[model samples]
Target: MGVWGFLKTQFVVHLLIGFVFVISGLIINFLQLCTLPLWGANKQLYRRINCRLSYSLWSQLVMLLEWWSGTQCTLFTDQETVDHFGKEHVIIILNHNFEIDFLCGWTMCERFGVLGSSKVLAKKELLMVPLIGWTWYFLEIVFCKRKWEEDRDTVIQGLQNLRDYPEYMWFLLYCEGTRFTETKHKISMEVADKKGLARLKYHLLPRTRGFTTAVQCLRGTVSAVYDVTLNFRENKNPSLLGILYGKKYEADMCVRRFPLEEIPLDEKEAADWLHKLYQEKDALQERYFQEGTFPGPQILPPPPAMDSPKLPILGHPPPLTSNLVCNWYLRQRLPPLLILSFLGFMWTASFAVRRLIGVTEIERGSSYGNSEVKKRD
Candidate 1:
């Protein structure tokens, strides 16, 4: 085979890359933990610095989905709505259909300069997913158990903690509470029918408790609720592994940001508001199916390379003027660098192992050949 063809089939090479990703992620999380001291000294600045620090590491993995994996993201949002998006804090409600929807959300966050600072109201089950989950802990990604009976109070407390997040953030909420499989969709429609709601063809029953709870808790602190619907072109089901392997696909994100005042402050009213919002979202999805896009003017963020920091650098280190700045800088750069360094080392070791050990190619014997002949060969 030619060199380019061989490169495409290099499974071990990809595994080596994944090792680098896992290692770098852990280092970022560790560095975030080390920022605890900075939090004590200057809470706001510490929170802000950590946001950037966490993004640098996480966005690398996100870039793997687009740059390395060749996935294309097409966001069709209103021009007026997106032009002022970076200036506000909003509750982002997304359709939980695709497995890599979170990654896609992260991609949007990366584009908007908020990937590291982005937050999610994720299920508790996700917190066990190794590097990604552990990193999310420091990012302050909220975890929900799905059982409102158990998660109500805990979810409220988690939202309350974000009242002081120092940077503009996009908090993602999957109102459906789970991915949409055909079986799950059927069950959700049944539930919706039981609740006296119309059946939705492309969705599962949304659990209103979590949405209401989040709205009620994050009311004053958040400015708006961004109702986001994500769908892939041609109904392609994309996975995280597929995205990492350079699989090309298109994703459409439709966003509608509404003022917080629209959501009711009362708990029951909040629940009703969520139901109504879902109904509207369902209608929007149907319209998208008919028209092939959301009803909005197109607005896209500038490419990532355009966002360069404006700070000047001196020839030598400054005399320790402020402990907070020192810690903030330390918290931002140290751990991710170390972890990424370590992962690179491990990946090199694994590549060496693959080279030195040498992979043995096995040839399949024909069914018509005699068993004894095959064994002799």
Candidate 2:
């Protein structure tokens, strides 16, 4: 293998990358915490600052997927569907079939200029994880315990908090609840049989509680539901570790937009609608397996130059100049420098701390020796 390829396989490289991510993430999390006082004074400005700070941390993982792993993600949907992607608030329902699915979602968020502000309905345990979890706490990401009774209020309140959010956001919901595996799929299908629901060959039955509550709470605030189904070509199961090891894969995401008004307002009806959506998503996956592509007309590729406008889509919104400037600075220039500075500062602080501790130990040892000498004399 080439030197670069050899380095990619080494554990040391992954450790260093992870270490940097954690330290830098914690730094950004601290900065986010510092914005708490500003919340009451200038809520919108506070949100904007947190969004930029979020981008600083999240862009590190995006860089790994886009630059280090060399993964190419393609969006397959009509231009009309995603034209207002970054400009509007939407709930993103995605299939949980891959470990790196969240990262894939983040990549799309980056494309749509909402990476920093993108939210998710994540598991409660994730709230305790360091760095990423701490950051999410500041981002107001909804966390659920997977128990309907326990999560109902928390989920609704979290969704309600976003009603007056300053920037556009894509709230992600993995209604499937857990990552897909054959064993879990089998058990889920059995439950579907017991419930007399349609059998889903490619996906587990979606938990509708979260979706229904989010829709009900965010009613006027969220415009549409983006039903996003993602799959990796050739790799039936893609893990985060594989991405870390520089595995290149092609990801296809098929997004279908549904107006929030069209989704039933009643809780029961909303739950049924989510089930039907999952059934359709299952059918799409079946088609993908057979055709090796999504069932849609391909949008023309954007120009090779980074500065060129992205591919045209239906109902595209005019670019926001402020957002564009923020995107450029955060995505392109800031993350790397911020991470490197954090690493340097951490290293220097650790060295200083160790030296200080050593000096104290040496002084104590000398004092003890002098005491012994005086006693002997």
Which candidate's TM-score is highest?
A: 2
lDDT of 2 by residue, 1-377 (tens): 68887888886565555545555566677888899999899988888888877776677677778777788888898988767777789999999777678888888887777878899998886677666778899888888887788888888888898999988889998888776766667777877999999999888888888888889888899999999999988745665666668888889989899999999989889989989998899889988898899988665323222311222220112222223433454565457778688557656544433332233231221231132245557
The Cα local distance difference test for each model comes to 0.67, 0.74
What 10-residue stretch in candidate 2 is worst by lDDT? Answer: 307-316
Which residue segments of model 2 deviate by more than 4 Å? 300-377
Tell me the spans in candidate 1 whose CA falls farther than 4 Å from its real position: 1-9, 305-377
- How good is model 1 by TM-score? 0.78
lDDT of 1 by residue, 217-327 (tens): 777888999888888877688765565455777888888878999887887888877777787888878887888777776555566523421112210011122223335
- Write out the backbone clash pairs for model 2: 79-314
Using Cα atoms with residue i matched to residue i, what is each candidate's TM-score against the true structure?
0.78, 0.79
Q: Give the top-scoring candidate (lDDT).
A: 2
